[model samples]
Target: MNKIRIGVLSTARIGRTKVIPGMQRAKRCEVTAICSRNEEAARRAAEELNIPKAYGSYAKLLADPDIDAVYIPLPNHLHVEWTLKAMAKGKHVLCEKPMGLNDGEVNRLINATALDPGVKVMEAFMYRFHPQWVETKRLVDQGAIGKPTSIQSFFSYFNADPDNIRNKADMGGGGLMDIGCYQVSLSRLLFNAQPRRAFGWMDKDPEFGTDRTFSGMLDFGGRLSTFTCSTQLAPYQRVNVLGEKGRIEIIIPFNAPPDAPTEILLQQNGETRTITFDACDQYTLQADAFAEAVLEDKPVPISIMDTFANQHTVDALFKSAQSDHWENC
Candidate 1:
């Protein structure tokens, strides 16, 4: 197929506002169908997004032979279950991150993928596909940053709504699972290695029983990464990658605006330069990249094994927070 015929698993806000629109812009993707448990909701979204098909239940969407792949934007807890089901029906999957609740859940998905070798499964970390990040990785690898040693990131937003999925612990809600996973993923991406150990501190919401504020440190042997994420705080996000001779700072790391230009700062030898990237949707890039991989039978940009490692580190950080000590990743 010239373009991968895609099906979206839900009418989730992220899918409706960001991922679906972005995928619609991709040349290699055709968002053919959308489904939600509520038939009316599915119809409304399908009409709004101009999708050709709508289904009240996920099973109906999965059974459609025309859909070459499925994008799962369900809550954290439902990610692995629906992803596995889609794969079982011979549909490729692009799942939203923190792909599983814990390492064991991630492992189960991993083993399932191994059994279904023909299918492609990838965790959606769209920020990695942004041009600014693409440029940052290039600069780091080319010695523009002079052997990166430390990475720091902060992501936060104020959301106290008890009804929101992100505030419900049973649905895998919290600052860490929702936003902190980006920090963990990017640290590994930049360091090009797994952390030896992890240390974490968290403040749980009394009523919600979910971590509202969390800070973690990853010891990457010689280098280190630290981050703080919060569900109740002023909204802000930034990432700084430091090296012996230089540093790179991302102004808006996550939730980058697709319609506006992005900027990054590079500092070296008492000089700083602002690198500007034209407005482009990372989601489109990500969708097209995944479509290319599926069409060409090539390995995905981010593997399930990489997802496992990221979750393992997150799991270790959680353990460290509870034990109040360093835990091996």
Candidate 2:
């Protein structure tokens, strides 16, 4: 395949505003179609994005023989459903993060993928594709920060609209599901170890039954990772990694803007150094990477197995908060 002919599974805000534009700029992919439950909405999105085709239903989009792959930005609850559907139709899938609500559902998708060995599947953790994170791993591996010891990450934004899908518990709404997942995944990536024990403290909105704010810790043997995520705080994000000899600080860790330069700070041996990176769209990089994997028959950079492990940690954090005790992952 010269370029992956992609179809978007939904006209979600992120799809139209970020991922589609990123796909357009990516070298090995083109978004050929878009789908929405409402025909007018799908038409509007297709027109705005300059996509060649639009379908009123997701099923129709999946059935399009021209679409070699599908980008799913549906709600969290619908992720597993449509991913399985798309894969069953022989289309490779790039589903949004937190692929399933729990381990059982995640396992189902894993099994489904196993039956279709030729199709590539990946969770859309765009940050993992960013050069900033690539440098972070290099610094750790090169021992620029000595033996890594801990990580602290924070992500938050105020959004309390009752009608918003993110505020609905049944739709997989919560601070952890929305943004804390980033912390859980990042800590594991930086440490290169699975956390054995987890603990959490959260405050739920009584009216919504969704966690509005949460703080959690993961014990990776002697090394510890702690994070606080909120859907009701002023918008802010950062990640700090401390080691025996020094520390690294990422100013805009999770949601770095695509059009602006980014940087990370390293402090060691009584001196500090700053590393800078040019602006690049992580979403575009993610699309291109997945396309290359599909075209060249290489394993996806962010494997579904990694997402399974991340969700396992997420489940432990939720269990810990409810039981008020440490839980093993």
Candidate 3:
């Protein structure tokens, strides 16, 4: 079988630490080129990652005939721009999540892909690829959850630096965009419905004009999901699912180490059952799936529906926060 030749669009932390390494370990992906706005950084990353070539600009790397795919770990705002650029060059694109800053941006992105037949575009969502979630989703759909009632989740970390992109309102910064987004995405995954109304409160830094904390509720049909996403809170990441039958809690749900055991605590009729996935690196699994999708000419099992739903909910919440009341999503 031929390998999928992938170009690294940026040497960002995700590329250097998680994505590049995962691609190297996957069966069907080859890291052909890495590019950076800074030539020195690109050269350094190419050397460290053992990639064959380095380019000083993303445009240069995209023009390389050997690159069949491009992995974009760019900022939230740059996602649409480069994904379109890559697709225009006849390369498939795997972008980091949020897809884009808002629904409009994602719509524009999909519009750009309409003209291409050989290429495809997808947003990287490693959590859904992990066996834990696949099993959880199966159980939920199998009536283990028994008509989901309400959900509570959070992704919080203190990024004390006010100047960081995560804290800048202009650059799509905030707790909501950073950690909070995961909660919203996972909630939709559990509820499997688009939220109709949203209400939220955000605490902003007067000096920076960006939010330090965000707490919100999404009304998905009859199920209401509450989320706390903040950059000021002490480090905590978890997901809790509630149903008519019982409840469950996932600790360190998003980024568990490969082969690291993950617990799924379930409660029903005052009796508790604990299950564990022995160990899995969701990132590696995610990379492998993307490669298979390209090589097999198959559609990804996970769809853009939930990704778009999450983006819609998040966009409404921000608008509601600005309006100081509930907003129709």
Q: What's the lDDT for residue 146 in model 2?
A: 96
Ranking of models by lDDT? 1, 2, 3
* Candidates, ranked, TM-score: 1, 2, 3
- Model 2 alpha-carbon miss at residue 52, Å: 0.6
- Per-residue lDDT over 120-230 for candidate 1, one digit per residue giving the tens place of the 0 to 100 score: 999999999999999999999999989999999999999999999999999999999999999999999999999999999999999999999999999999899999999
Locate the minimum summed-lDDT window of 10 residues in model 3. 300-309
Candidate that beats the other on TM-score, 2 or 3, i.e. the better one: 2
Give the least accurate 10-residue stretch of model 2, judged by summed lDDT.
108-117
TM-score of each: 0.99, 0.99, 0.95
**Count of clashes in candidate 2:** 0
Q: How does model 3 score by TM-score?
A: 0.95
Query: Of models 1 and 3, which has the larger lDDT?
Result: 1
Predicted candidate 2 versus true structure: per-residue lDDT over 1-329, tens digit per residue: 68999999989999999999998999999999999999899999999999999999999999999999999999899999999999999999999988999988899988987888899999999998999999999999889989999899899999989988889999999899989999999999999988999999999999999999999999999999999999999999999999999999999998878999999999999899999999999999999999999999999998888889999999999999999999999
lDDT of 3: 0.83
Candidate with best lDDT: 1
* CA RMSD of all predictions: 0.6, 0.7, 1.6
How does residue 312 of candidate 3 score in lDDT?
Answer: 82
